[model samples]
Target: MLLMTSIIITISTIILLKNKKSDLLDLKSEIKSISWPDKKEVNQSMLTVTLIIISASLIIWLIDSTLTFLISKII
Candidate 1:
Protein backbone atom coordinates (compact mmCIF):
# COMPACT_ATOMS: atom_id res chain seq x y z
CA MET A 1 0.00 0.00 0.00
CA LEU A 2 2.77 2.40 0.88
CA LEU A 3 4.62 1.68 -2.33
CA MET A 4 1.45 2.13 -4.37
CA THR A 5 0.62 5.41 -2.63
CA SER A 6 4.15 6.75 -3.16
CA ILE A 7 4.06 5.86 -6.87
CA ILE A 8 0.68 7.57 -7.29
CA ILE A 9 1.87 10.71 -5.49
CA THR A 10 5.11 10.81 -7.49
CA ILE A 11 3.25 10.44 -10.80
CA SER A 12 0.71 13.12 -9.93
CA THR A 13 3.38 15.55 -8.77
CA ILE A 14 5.41 14.99 -11.93
CA ILE A 15 2.32 15.58 -14.07
CA LEU A 16 1.49 18.76 -12.14
CA LEU A 17 5.03 20.13 -12.41
CA LYS A 18 5.12 19.36 -16.12
CA ASN A 19 1.85 21.25 -16.64
CA LYS A 20 3.00 24.26 -14.58
CA LYS A 21 6.32 24.61 -16.43
CA SER A 22 4.59 26.41 -19.29
CA ASP A 23 3.51 29.29 -17.03
CA LEU A 24 5.78 32.32 -16.64
CA LEU A 25 7.76 32.35 -13.40
CA ASP A 26 7.16 35.51 -11.36
CA LEU A 27 9.00 36.03 -8.09
CA LYS A 28 8.16 39.69 -7.44
CA SER A 29 4.56 39.41 -6.37
CA GLU A 30 2.09 36.72 -5.41
CA ILE A 31 -0.09 35.91 -8.43
CA LYS A 32 -2.40 33.45 -6.77
CA SER A 33 -4.49 34.26 -3.71
CA ILE A 34 -3.71 32.11 -0.71
CA SER A 35 -6.50 31.40 1.66
CA TRP A 36 -5.61 29.67 4.88
CA PRO A 37 -8.22 27.48 6.45
CA ASP A 38 -10.07 29.03 9.36
CA LYS A 39 -9.78 27.59 12.84
CA LYS A 40 -13.10 25.80 12.51
CA GLU A 41 -12.05 24.22 9.22
CA VAL A 42 -8.71 23.14 10.60
CA ASN A 43 -10.37 21.67 13.64
CA GLN A 44 -12.84 19.80 11.46
CA SER A 45 -10.07 18.37 9.31
CA MET A 46 -8.10 17.28 12.36
CA LEU A 47 -11.20 15.64 13.79
CA THR A 48 -11.78 13.81 10.53
CA VAL A 49 -8.21 12.53 10.40
CA THR A 50 -8.34 11.43 14.01
CA LEU A 51 -11.61 9.61 13.46
CA ILE A 52 -10.28 7.79 10.41
CA ILE A 53 -7.08 6.74 12.17
CA ILE A 54 -8.97 5.49 15.20
CA SER A 55 -11.47 3.60 13.07
CA ALA A 56 -8.80 1.92 11.00
CA SER A 57 -6.80 0.94 14.08
CA LEU A 58 -9.91 -0.52 15.69
CA ILE A 59 -10.73 -2.52 12.59
CA ILE A 60 -7.21 -3.93 12.33
CA TRP A 61 -7.15 -4.83 16.00
CA LEU A 62 -10.55 -6.54 15.75
CA ILE A 63 -9.46 -8.59 12.78
CA ASP A 64 -6.23 -9.70 14.46
CA SER A 65 -8.00 -10.51 17.68
CA THR A 66 -10.65 -12.59 15.90
CA LEU A 67 -8.04 -14.55 13.98
CA THR A 68 -6.01 -15.23 17.11
CA PHE A 69 -9.10 -16.34 19.03
CA LEU A 70 -10.17 -18.65 16.25
CA ILE A 71 -6.71 -20.18 15.94
CA SER A 72 -6.46 -20.78 19.69
CA LYS A 73 -9.86 -22.44 19.73
CA ILE A 74 -8.92 -24.71 16.85
CA ILE A 75 -5.73 -25.76 18.62
Candidate 2:
Protein backbone atom coordinates (compact mmCIF):
# COMPACT_ATOMS: atom_id res chain seq x y z
CA MET A 1 0.00 0.00 0.00
CA LEU A 2 2.81 2.38 0.85
CA LEU A 3 4.65 1.46 -2.33
CA MET A 4 1.54 2.00 -4.41
CA THR A 5 0.91 5.36 -2.87
CA SER A 6 4.48 6.44 -3.48
CA ILE A 7 4.34 5.35 -7.09
CA ILE A 8 1.07 7.15 -7.63
CA ILE A 9 2.41 10.33 -6.12
CA THR A 10 5.56 10.11 -8.22
CA ILE A 11 3.64 9.63 -11.43
CA SER A 12 1.28 12.46 -10.60
CA THR A 13 4.15 14.75 -9.79
CA ILE A 14 5.79 13.89 -13.08
CA ILE A 15 2.63 14.70 -14.99
CA LEU A 16 2.24 17.97 -13.17
CA LEU A 17 5.83 18.94 -13.85
CA LYS A 18 5.55 18.02 -17.51
CA ASN A 19 2.48 20.21 -17.90
CA LYS A 20 4.15 23.11 -16.09
CA LYS A 21 1.44 23.07 -13.47
CA SER A 22 4.03 23.16 -10.72
CA ASP A 23 5.35 26.52 -11.84
CA LEU A 24 5.11 29.37 -9.40
CA LEU A 25 3.20 32.51 -10.35
CA ASP A 26 6.19 34.86 -10.18
CA LEU A 27 8.79 32.34 -11.36
CA LYS A 28 9.98 33.07 -14.90
CA SER A 29 12.23 30.08 -15.44
CA GLU A 30 11.22 26.56 -14.37
CA ILE A 31 14.69 25.27 -13.50
CA LYS A 32 15.79 28.32 -11.52
CA SER A 33 12.43 29.03 -9.98
CA ILE A 34 11.65 25.64 -8.48
CA SER A 35 12.55 25.22 -4.83
CA TRP A 36 14.14 21.86 -4.07
CA PRO A 37 15.24 20.64 -0.66
CA ASP A 38 18.70 19.40 0.14
CA LYS A 39 19.25 16.11 -1.65
CA LYS A 40 21.17 14.60 1.27
CA GLU A 41 18.41 15.30 3.73
CA VAL A 42 15.72 13.87 1.44
CA ASN A 43 17.79 10.74 0.79
CA GLN A 44 18.47 10.21 4.48
CA SER A 45 14.81 10.55 5.38
CA MET A 46 13.78 8.11 2.64
CA LEU A 47 16.40 5.62 3.73
CA THR A 48 15.23 5.75 7.34
CA VAL A 49 11.58 5.27 6.42
CA THR A 50 12.38 2.41 4.07
CA LEU A 51 14.47 0.65 6.67
CA ILE A 52 11.77 0.97 9.31
CA ILE A 53 9.08 -0.43 7.02
CA ILE A 54 11.26 -3.30 5.87
CA SER A 55 12.23 -4.27 9.40
CA ALA A 56 8.67 -4.17 10.63
CA SER A 57 7.47 -6.25 7.69
CA LEU A 58 10.17 -8.83 8.18
CA ILE A 59 9.31 -9.13 11.86
CA ILE A 60 5.63 -9.55 11.12
CA TRP A 61 6.30 -12.21 8.50
CA LEU A 62 8.56 -14.12 10.83
CA ILE A 63 5.97 -14.12 13.58
CA ASP A 64 3.21 -15.23 11.21
CA SER A 65 5.24 -18.05 9.68
CA THR A 66 6.44 -19.30 13.05
CA LEU A 67 2.92 -19.48 14.39
CA THR A 68 1.71 -21.26 11.28
CA PHE A 69 4.51 -23.79 11.49
CA LEU A 70 3.92 -24.47 15.18
CA ILE A 71 0.18 -24.93 14.69
CA SER A 72 0.71 -27.35 11.84
CA LYS A 73 3.17 -29.35 13.81
CA ILE A 74 0.80 -29.60 16.77
CA ILE A 75 -2.11 -30.73 14.59
Candidate 3:
Protein backbone atom coordinates (compact mmCIF):
# COMPACT_ATOMS: atom_id res chain seq x y z
CA MET A 1 0.00 0.00 0.00
CA LEU A 2 1.01 3.61 -0.48
CA LEU A 3 0.61 4.33 3.23
CA MET A 4 2.94 1.48 4.19
CA THR A 5 5.57 2.60 1.66
CA SER A 6 5.44 6.21 2.90
CA ILE A 7 5.78 5.09 6.52
CA ILE A 8 8.74 2.85 5.71
CA ILE A 9 10.50 5.61 3.78
CA THR A 10 9.92 8.15 6.56
CA ILE A 11 11.25 5.83 9.27
CA SER A 12 14.29 4.77 7.23
CA THR A 13 15.16 8.35 6.34
CA ILE A 14 14.87 9.47 9.96
CA ILE A 15 17.09 6.63 11.16
CA LEU A 16 19.69 7.35 8.49
CA LEU A 17 19.74 11.03 9.45
CA LYS A 18 19.80 10.56 13.26
CA ASN A 19 21.68 7.33 14.03
CA LYS A 20 25.49 7.41 13.90
CA LYS A 21 28.19 4.72 14.25
CA SER A 22 29.37 5.59 17.77
CA ASP A 23 25.81 5.85 19.14
CA LEU A 24 24.88 2.46 17.67
CA LEU A 25 28.06 0.91 19.02
CA ASP A 26 27.37 2.25 22.50
CA LEU A 27 23.79 0.88 22.38
CA LYS A 28 25.07 -2.55 21.32
CA SER A 29 27.61 -2.60 24.16
CA GLU A 30 24.96 -1.68 26.75
CA ILE A 31 22.68 -4.42 25.39
CA LYS A 32 25.49 -6.98 25.67
CA SER A 33 26.03 -6.12 29.35
CA ILE A 34 22.48 -7.07 30.42
CA SER A 35 22.19 -10.16 32.69
CA TRP A 36 19.16 -12.09 31.45
CA PRO A 37 17.26 -14.49 33.77
CA ASP A 38 17.46 -18.31 33.50
CA LYS A 39 14.65 -20.56 32.20
CA LYS A 40 13.41 -21.65 35.64
CA GLU A 41 13.07 -18.09 36.89
CA VAL A 42 11.23 -17.08 33.70
CA ASN A 43 8.73 -19.96 34.10
CA GLN A 44 8.06 -19.12 37.75
CA SER A 45 7.43 -15.46 36.96
CA MET A 46 5.15 -16.33 34.03
CA LEU A 47 3.10 -18.66 36.25
CA THR A 48 2.64 -15.94 38.88
CA VAL A 49 1.44 -13.44 36.24
CA THR A 50 -0.98 -15.99 34.70
CA LEU A 51 -2.52 -16.83 38.10
CA ILE A 52 -2.99 -13.16 38.95
CA ILE A 53 -4.68 -12.42 35.61
CA ILE A 54 -7.13 -15.35 35.99
CA SER A 55 -7.99 -14.35 39.58
CA ALA A 56 -8.73 -10.75 38.56
CA SER A 57 -10.90 -11.83 35.60
CA LEU A 58 -13.02 -14.11 37.80
CA ILE A 59 -13.50 -11.35 40.38
CA ILE A 60 -14.68 -8.91 37.67
CA TRP A 61 -17.12 -11.48 36.23
CA LEU A 62 -18.60 -12.13 39.70
CA ILE A 63 -19.11 -8.41 40.36
CA ASP A 64 -20.73 -7.83 36.93
CA SER A 65 -23.14 -10.74 37.37
CA THR A 66 -24.14 -9.62 40.87
CA LEU A 67 -24.84 -6.08 39.68
CA THR A 68 -26.91 -7.28 36.70
CA PHE A 69 -28.98 -9.59 38.93
CA LEU A 70 -29.67 -6.85 41.46
CA ILE A 71 -30.66 -4.31 38.77
CA SER A 72 -33.08 -6.77 37.09
CA LYS A 73 -34.85 -7.50 40.42
CA ILE A 74 -35.24 -3.80 41.16
CA ILE A 75 -36.85 -3.09 37.74
Candidate 4:
Protein backbone atom coordinates (compact mmCIF):
# COMPACT_ATOMS: atom_id res chain seq x y z
CA MET A 1 0.00 0.00 0.00
CA LEU A 2 2.79 2.42 0.86
CA LEU A 3 4.63 1.71 -2.39
CA MET A 4 1.44 2.19 -4.42
CA THR A 5 0.77 5.48 -2.65
CA SER A 6 4.31 6.67 -3.34
CA ILE A 7 4.09 5.77 -7.01
CA ILE A 8 0.74 7.56 -7.36
CA ILE A 9 2.08 10.65 -5.66
CA THR A 10 5.17 10.73 -7.86
CA ILE A 11 3.13 10.45 -11.07
CA SER A 12 0.70 13.15 -9.97
CA THR A 13 3.55 15.47 -8.99
CA ILE A 14 5.26 15.09 -12.38
CA ILE A 15 1.99 15.76 -14.22
CA LEU A 16 1.22 18.84 -12.16
CA LEU A 17 4.73 20.29 -12.57
CA LYS A 18 4.52 19.94 -16.33
CA ASN A 19 1.00 21.31 -16.73
CA LYS A 20 1.20 24.12 -14.19
CA LYS A 21 4.28 25.85 -15.61
CA SER A 22 2.27 27.53 -18.38
CA ASP A 23 -0.60 28.36 -15.96
CA LEU A 24 1.90 30.00 -13.57
CA LEU A 25 3.41 32.04 -16.39
CA ASP A 26 -0.07 33.19 -17.43
CA LEU A 27 -0.85 34.18 -13.83
CA LYS A 28 2.34 36.21 -13.61
CA SER A 29 1.44 38.11 -16.76
CA GLU A 30 -2.09 38.74 -15.52
CA ILE A 31 -0.79 40.06 -12.20
CA LYS A 32 1.56 42.44 -13.98
CA SER A 33 -1.37 43.77 -16.05
CA ILE A 34 -3.49 44.58 -13.00
CA SER A 35 -3.92 48.22 -11.88
CA TRP A 36 -3.02 48.15 -8.22
CA PRO A 37 -4.39 50.86 -5.94
CA ASP A 38 -2.10 53.77 -5.01
CA LYS A 39 -1.25 54.57 -1.40
CA LYS A 40 -3.68 57.50 -1.22
CA GLU A 41 -6.51 55.41 -2.67
CA VAL A 42 -5.75 52.63 -0.20
CA ASN A 43 -5.81 55.03 2.75
CA GLN A 44 -9.11 56.53 1.64
CA SER A 45 -10.65 53.07 1.23
CA MET A 46 -9.47 52.03 4.70
CA LEU A 47 -10.90 55.20 6.27
CA THR A 48 -14.26 54.67 4.57
CA VAL A 49 -14.39 51.07 5.75
CA THR A 50 -13.56 52.07 9.33
CA LEU A 51 -16.25 54.75 9.40
CA ILE A 52 -18.87 52.34 8.03
CA ILE A 53 -17.93 49.70 10.60
CA ILE A 54 -18.13 52.20 13.50
CA SER A 55 -21.47 53.56 12.32
CA ALA A 56 -22.93 50.07 12.02
CA SER A 57 -21.68 49.10 15.46
CA LEU A 58 -23.22 52.19 17.05
CA ILE A 59 -26.55 51.58 15.33
CA ILE A 60 -26.62 47.96 16.48
CA TRP A 61 -25.73 48.96 20.03
CA LEU A 62 -28.49 51.53 20.14
CA ILE A 63 -31.05 48.97 18.97
CA ASP A 64 -29.83 46.42 21.51
CA SER A 65 -29.99 48.94 24.35
CA THR A 66 -33.49 50.04 23.38
CA LEU A 67 -34.72 46.44 23.34
CA THR A 68 -33.06 45.68 26.67
CA PHE A 69 -34.67 48.72 28.29
CA LEU A 70 -38.13 47.81 27.01
CA ILE A 71 -37.69 44.22 28.15
CA SER A 72 -36.61 45.33 31.60
CA LYS A 73 -39.55 47.65 31.92
CA ILE A 74 -42.03 44.88 30.95
CA ILE A 75 -40.52 42.44 33.43
How many clashes in each candidate? 0, 0, 0, 0
Shift of residue 11 alpha carbon in model 1, Å: 33
The TM-score between candidate 3 and the true structure equals 0.70
Clash total of candidate 1: 0
Rank all candidate structures by their TM-score, best first, as comma-separated numbers: 4, 3, 1, 2
lDDT, candidate 2, at 74: 100
TM match of model 2 to true structure: 0.50
Q: Which of the predicted structures, 3 or 4, would earn the higher lDDT when compared with the native? A: 4
lDDT of each: 0.87, 0.88, 0.95, 0.98
Clashing pairs in 1: none
Error of 4 at 42 (Å): 0.7
For residues 1-75, could you state the per-residue lDDT of candidate 1 as single tens digits? Answer: 999999999999999997676554542234555568999999999999999999999999999999999999999
Per lDDT, the best of the predicted structures is 4
Per-residue alpha-carbon lDDT of model 2 for 34-68, expressed as tens digits? Answer: 87879998999999999999999999999999999
Model 3 segments more than 4 A misplaced: 1-19
Q: Which stretch of 10 consecutive residues in model 2 shows the poorest summed lDDT? A: 21-30
Per-residue lDDT of model 4, residues 1-75, tens digit only:
999999999999999998899899999999999999999999999999999999999999999999999999999
